[model samples]
Target: MPDAQTPQLAFHNVSFAFDETPVLRNVSFELSSGETLIVLGAAGSGKTVLLKTALGLLRPTQGRVVLFGADVTAGSEREWFDIRSRIGVLFQEGGLFDSLDVADNVAYPLRNQPLRQCPEEQVLPKVEESLKFVDLGHTLDKYPSELSGGMRRRVGIARAIVTQPELMLYDSPTAGLDPITANIIVALITKGRDVRNATTVMVTHRFQDGEILAGFRYDTAAGGLGLTPDHRGDTQTRFLVLREGEMVFLGTQAELEASQDSYVSKFVPHT
Candidate 1:
């Protein structure tokens, strides 16, 4: 079991290389439970690589990755299966099975459990509950082809949260969508963080998305999400900016904006 003060996820001097080309160099960070970490970077700056490393899909060439206080850097696939169950990943393209309907897509993880068998009767309710959480209960019977890009992303969110994962990883959940749809996706992410209280690490190229997520809070009493005026300091949400395989900035939104680094300052103002 993880200690009370153990970070949900931690990277210790992690580095990776594709042959001679280094992808991540000396990356280090810790994500505590109930906190959201937003990673921002330009293309090829190792944003997605960070998520893959956390998921154990790509091993670090150097250093270690700790999840729930347990070293997972060299863990076997069998070990990884247990670790992965407690984490959820939402890919950029909403990687739902084209043949499966919304419900089935959401139910895939539960039904495929290797350690414990889950009956359809038990799984069906979870599917419904997950879809409902994303406001997609009515899309249960609809196939992926029948859903719009935004709807597909919503279903992806439903699928990701169905297991009520302790940690959620999002890779550009709002990419390639209109402002309205992107805001909707952002709201769902907020709901996951606020309502479900899941730890999150999200990668995005858009600074506005990061700003909004860090600035907003789900107001249960008000029945809507509201922004923290002036996007003031939010300790719950932190930013990590990478530039060419190195961490350039790591701080709260206010600190990020206050950064004087040439790369960070240039990137923040335009984004």
Candidate 2:
């Protein structure tokens, strides 16, 4: 078993800047094997930049991005792909291939691999199973152009998890969708946490988005994202409120709500 002390995913004093423009400053956090890490930041607050850093698409100017204690800051692309395979990321947009139908799009990742885990016969069943999880079984023959935004997002999710990754990263999964559909997506995400024992990371700004995450929390192990016994409420979840690329507050959800800071208060819900 992995050490209880070693975090599954970790960022330590991570600082990154583009030329003179600073994005993330001394950001640090740890996510366990089965915990859900929700990141709340306003528009242009470097949330996306942080995801890129985690994915190795962006390198940190200082500190480290660690996965299972292995530093990713200096790895080659080929070296990174090994780590990337263990992670599944849901992009802001569905990021589907318009040319391919849903099934093909979901199966695309397996096609590029140099070796097959199972026989060729296993591919179709896995594809079907993945789509089934997202409730997209009927849309298999349809192209991304033919699907609704919600369906596209679900399809993207199906594609991401088709590989059975250890970690799941969501980038604005509910953006540009109606409230009803967004809620459905939230439920689907929660269901995913229940079905697969995968660590989760989500980035969004809506209070409802925060609420959906709050909903993901519960006293019992069932409600939370498969968190271990050591962490009931002890699991740490903090928010970093950023403005013009600088952090103004770093604390809990309640702390963020009660904050007297003008930037934070303005962003809080009217109620």
TM-score top scorer = 1
**Using Cα atoms with residue i matched to residue i, what is each candidate's TM-score against the true structure?**
0.94, 0.85
lDDT of 2 by residue, 1-271 (tens): 4586677789888888999788988888788787777776778888888888899988989989998678888899887877887788888997899999998898877665433344567778989999987788889899999999999999999988888877888888999999998977776776665466677787777656655554454323454344335432443445556565555676666677789988777767875
User: Which residue pairs clash in candidate 1?
Assistant: none
Off by over 4 Å in 1: 115-117, 229-231
Q: TM-score of predicted model 2?
A: 0.85
Clashing pairs in 2: none
lDDT of 1 by residue, 217-252 (tens): 777788678876665455289999999989989988
lDDT of each: 0.88, 0.76
